[model samples]
Target: MPARTSRMTLGRLLGLSRENNRARDWFFEDSGNLLPHHRHHELNPSIPPLEVTKIALRLRHLIEECVPCELEESLITQAHSRVITREVVLAAKEAGGEEYRSCVVFALLVCSRWFKRQAHLELWDATLHNVRSTACEVIAKAIIEGEEDMSYLLHTVLLHRFSILVNGKPTPPANAVEKAVDLHALRVICSSGYQKCLQYLWRGWLVQDEDDPTVFVDYRGRDDQRYIVHLDPDRLRAPVYQNIARLLFSFIYLALYTMSINSVNPNGEFDAAEILLFLFTLGFICDEFTKFWKAGYHILSFWSAFNGVLYAVLTVSFVCRMIGLSYPIGHELRHSYDSLSYNFLAFAAPMFWIRLLLYLDSFRFFGAMLVVLKVMMKESIIFFALLAVMVVGFLQAFIGLDLAEDLKTDEIWFIIQAMANSVMQSPEFDGFEKFAPPFGILLYYVFTFIVMVILLNILIALYGSAYSDIYENADDEYMALFAQKTMEFVRAPDENVYIAPFNLVEIGVIVLFSWWLPKRQYEFVNDVVMAILYSPLLLIAAYFESRKAGEIRRNRSRGEDDDDTVEEWEQIEDQIDFEAEGWTKRCAAVKANVETDPAVIEVRKLMDEVAELKLMIAELKKGMDGANGKKKDDVKKGSEGDGEDS
Candidate 1:
């Protein structure tokens, strides 16, 4: 039978069987071969048997009349061969094994074919599961092979599925089927693959050989269409790089964790030492490539560099410990000396680099170079105070004025000797442990407190103030732009002359007030003073600006007689009265107009009504006092009876 004819017959049989048990039995057992003959006969006999034979005969007659096909001798055999069967499906499921991964591949092929043949099939759940499982396997292999293209596609698909799932809260269950797939398991299986893919993609661009342009082209253009249409390279690359950085940052955290544990028991293995080293190396490379420094350099770079140094030191110490345990020197004394030298390097390397990086990035360095000349010119007193503190500290340290009393102990002696060896061998940290005298100690403390702490705070405050002023001015500028555009469109006079400047001034005042005052005082000051100062200014400005614009519009609409002009004037006065009435009514109707928050509106209405009642009571008290005074005067004049009569 033709495929279409067979599908139509199947649909009709299912539809007709919905109302009749005998027809359903005939279709499921004899016509479709969904059940074996022995089981069917046994089940049928046990149950109150349906007249399935008669129903099958009727279905056969219908098919023969309506469907253009040769009548088959055995419908079960024809159905079994033509459509998906229980045995074929069971075999397919069984074929899916760890060693072969046959089930995943077969499922993908079957699902694709099913979708193509029956486009409206309600098989999204099954299809999604098959796709997810297949994708997991493919991603795992791709990760092992360092294939970025596959990894990118997998990540994109995951993100898309996540978005769909999140957006499907109120949607139908079928819409969220893709989101319900086991994403966590997939991610775990594909993590190594993603890492490898990221590594390849990051390094691929750097390996462009000037002698071979084709390699560069191939590297970039392998799936250009897919990248352009499906993925945002910047968005994808940024997160991946950040992930790499975070992984590197974890090394420092791991070291800290190890250190904390070691503080309790120093002999345990530092399991994170190698991991720290690996992460630091990866982070450094990513940081260099990403140019994150261009955006904001201070805290981020400093922290990254500091952590990198700390991890590097820990890694070196671990290496030294491993070597010390594994290998022995020629003599006992020599071995001890060598061990001390390695230990000294481990500590000194990190300290030296960390201090050097800080010194290089110091504000004093910038100040001396005259890089911030404008700041120096404007804030000379603050700058000089900071510089003097730094200079005093430097001189004291250089002169060795803060020497500490020597602690005479075997450990101290050993440490000193180890440092001497390190200095001799490494040519680094020549005078690292030398203690400065008392004056130097005082100077250092003063400099740290005065130059670093105080000066830094002042600079922060200055920058904050400047940022506020700029932001407020920017808002005013945007308002000006809006006003200019509105005027241009309406062909009106510069009515903004009155209103725009006042609005700008009001915004400026608010910004300045916020800057000077603490947050707690804002409501008090803004409530009492802001309305008094700004309300009248805004109202006056708006009145003049509106009048100016109106006059310009009226002039443009000239060339009418006195009667028409008088009519226009009357209309204008009517509009003015109407607006005045509207404003009064609107003040009364505000509680009804605002629907955003019912609770807030109710509270505001209560407050307003209370204020109105208080004002009305005050006015009534004043009128009663005036009337009482007049009655008292009449009584004093002996006209109390006449006044009462009147």
Candidate 2:
């Protein structure tokens, strides 16, 4: 039989699993401690709260005893050299047993109640805040080293789960699991001087050096540096910059399409703008097709579905426009096709503007609103399902009544339309009364009451509930969106990124000829072509990055910190008592007072004395009772002996 599927694999606990490490040597190793390795059914919410707390405390104590090590020397050397080979990552598993065990304990501690409330801050201070040989350092170093699969590690560890199991399990959590970027992780990284470590990872993704293909280049200032310094944090390759450019392209293309429909004559020959718009439309259709193929069912999200409808309309309009252009200008068919094309294109206007919200979600308000809207839409499904059944039942009743009376006075379509209008608050009661007089009017009134007063209110309540849930966690929801947006660029990476209309050029020209070329030659050709095509963007990026670097250097020379400092004073502007002591000082004072107060000292001493006295009294009482019991037993035995002799 295959090895039994184990819960809480040692590799995962040690933070060296396949998801986080590219090395093949990273495999599942069970700790072999049965109690600590209990399955989901044995522990979790199934157990009593007190028992759970005791177990969690035991795990915390075990974790505290572990001594985690810093990044290995070989890993540091490889990082400095700008390339950490797979051998190094694999080698770690063979010889770094103690280090891996330490990581396991740290992981357990982080995923527990030990990392909550005041303990949360203390844990951070103990492990991540200027503590040497820390688990946090291991993670940070892994990210900075840019080896194996660090993306998963970064994404996984920073994610906060509402319902995490104390012990690992194959089954997912039964309760609703709410995951978001950890605010504590964000705060700690910003405040505890891990800024450069994060920057290294960000820059690794942003900067794509022309010379290096195998490794992410780290651009050091010195000329003697291992990697090239020219493209350190290349703004052109940055997702933020690329996404902005794409948005601008879309805006311009949409504008041109609108102008062509309104201003340009339908029968006129294609102008430069019209031709460019057509090319962009084709590019968009192709991009959509590619996304659908790669993403499969995942592409069926709300935004994607909206784009589907928008693109479908655009496609039909374009096809009609093309067919119309082919026909003679004065022909009847040509005129009809032109009108149809314009009408269809005009119908897509609202979609174009509505699509703007999807892209503008980088803003906090927009991001949070999108989440709320998504929740509302999901909740509306119940309302729609109920409405559908009611509509069917009511429509059948109206249709059957019309047929039964031969009152062919109203058509089936008319009755259907009237019912829809009633739902919209414009009921035609006059027509309903003409059908069965009293019964028809009564039924119509009942339906209206049920729909308007009951169903509609239920829908409103559902919407309110959905909105409240999203609103309560609005900040976390927005952070999750932000993290997702960042990960989008990290995941599903394209070796040669061809954005929109430029993709047409890449597909039509480069891809056609690249089939016969060697892999290396093909990559070289792609790089050269991309460089030539995006030279203007690259030039702009270089200028900005250079300016930013200069600003950093100047700040360093002036002995100013390069990091962003949280202005405590500025944040207190709204406070009424500007002269009042800060919370930090007050907290410190309270703690000091509790520790040093004379009355508190006296109380503690008295309590200790009382506890000792109670223990002594209990021991003395036990001794006296044992002696009395022995004497009673002896006397009873003597009496029994006398009776036996008689």
Candidate 3:
């Protein structure tokens, strides 16, 4: 189709009808728990050649219109019937567009409503896996793009559904059976969705080339072509880049620290700029430590060690500076103690290199090599430490021999050199037993062989094994890493403004002033001044970014090929069965939660009591019947006796 005609035709494919107009008033974003809002009105609008979109849109609207208490099974089934149909999915694949993708995702939320309907978890997961695994990219692309129509239609329905499941569980139930059913269903959906999301993440990452000239699906979703030109992160160009703001801030912190002490007062009293910069560095490092702790960093990761080491160095330097500052100028302690801070600061300069590598962690080769090195280092360090002690002992022993008579340095240095396979003129024991016995040379050679051949080979083996495991899981590991980074980058709402001094200023400006100001005035300042003043740089960048984004969308509308053929390596057939086990585990977990739920426990107790009461009532009725029969028998026997007497 020609560009003009494609626009003329597809543009008109959807328009604001009276039906959708009503839905526009109270549009629900991606929170699966629907609040009762204008429920008296309902609409089902359709755009042809894309029935899936229509179905998904209506279904989403339906979900928002009714809460779980009021949600009708018929409505759920109806929505699901439309979603399960091939019309939407096929439309998405054929059109190769976001709109079609959006429809399929919308349709998929029917699973949330139908959660109570499906009970057998493993079977349900298997069914969903087999059905949706192939279309992982389609679903992921929808999430990645995350485009909302002007009407606020097509939000992240699956994520919304997850929120609903998590929050809806603890509520007091109107019906225990219904609640249990829903709980089981929600758990199934959540578990299945997580596995499905992993597949989605994998499929999305599978196609990315990092070097793609056009664009790659990243968390920022900004046009990389324009954004890469000026990589001034935390400035105008920063927000447009994906997952680089914190990294950029780290570099900025390094720069501030380096520049702080370059020119100190001749009198040894640090200038105000120097003091200010040190304070900034201290604040930044503390924040980094806080973020590090909050992120739950493992000691096993090289970055964790790097961050910890940097923070420690900065802390020691800060303490020295503070101690020096405490003393009066021209005092002997001031200059002398201040130099200690400078000394530590100099040591920390090398850490900036490690920070750079950590920032570029998304690079595959860089990351893979780091993984290999980390494994090698972690495994060998302890062993080498022990070997160092033994080697020192041997060297001490060797120094006592006549062979060490010409040694210049300590025996420990010669031992270290020999063990490191370095050239050394000393420790030349010619014709054994010059000062020591022949047994000495024999022991030394034995130790050398063990250290050189055995330990070296062991270290090699450990590195090789670690590398192999990492290599085997390279794709999954990278995808998981990328996904986590992206999620973390976007997870915090304040990350945009949380850079050093600005964050401190925000406390006073936002917390103190806002409390003193009237509600309307404060909100006005927040909405207008603070938003614009702090973020205009981002806003301008966004405008230019949107222009580029518009071009990409136009290209997409013209039917550019976005779908990548599944490579042999990227095929997920093997993963589905593997995930099937995970799904089963999740099923067991959900079943356990449902069984142990307090509400269910109480319901069980009541039922048990009711059964006992019924049993007691039945026994009492049986006794009464027996008494009535005895009275009748007594009267009959008396009548017979009277007749006999007559």
Candidate closest to the true structure, highest lDDT: 2
- Model 1 residue 422 lDDT score: 32
List the candidates' TM-scores in order.
0.22, 0.60, 0.45
Tens digits of per-residue lDDT for model 1, 234-315: 1111222223333334445446434533332223223454344434444444443333443355224434566556546555
Taking all chains together, the TM-score of candidate 1 against the true structure is 0.22
The 0-to-1 C-alpha lDDT of every candidate, in the order given, reads 0.35, 0.54, 0.46
Q: TM-score order of candidates, best first?
A: 2, 3, 1
Worst 10 residues of 1 by lDDT: 1-10
Indicate the TM-score of model 3.
0.45
Better of 2 and 3 by TM-score: 2
Query: How would you encode candidate 2's per-residue C-alpha lDDT over 369-484 as one tens digit per residue?
Result: 99899889999999889989989998888777877788564668878888898788778887777877777778888888878888889999999999998898787667556555
Give the clashing pairs for model 2.
none
Estimate, for each residue in 72-187, the C-alpha lDDT of model 3 and write its tens digit: 33322332232323454344333325433323443434334343233245564544432332223333233333333311221122221111222334222111112212232222
Which is the winner by TM-score between candidate 1 and candidate 2?
A: 2
Off by over 4 Å in 1: 1-304, 315-319, 322-326, 329-390, 393-646
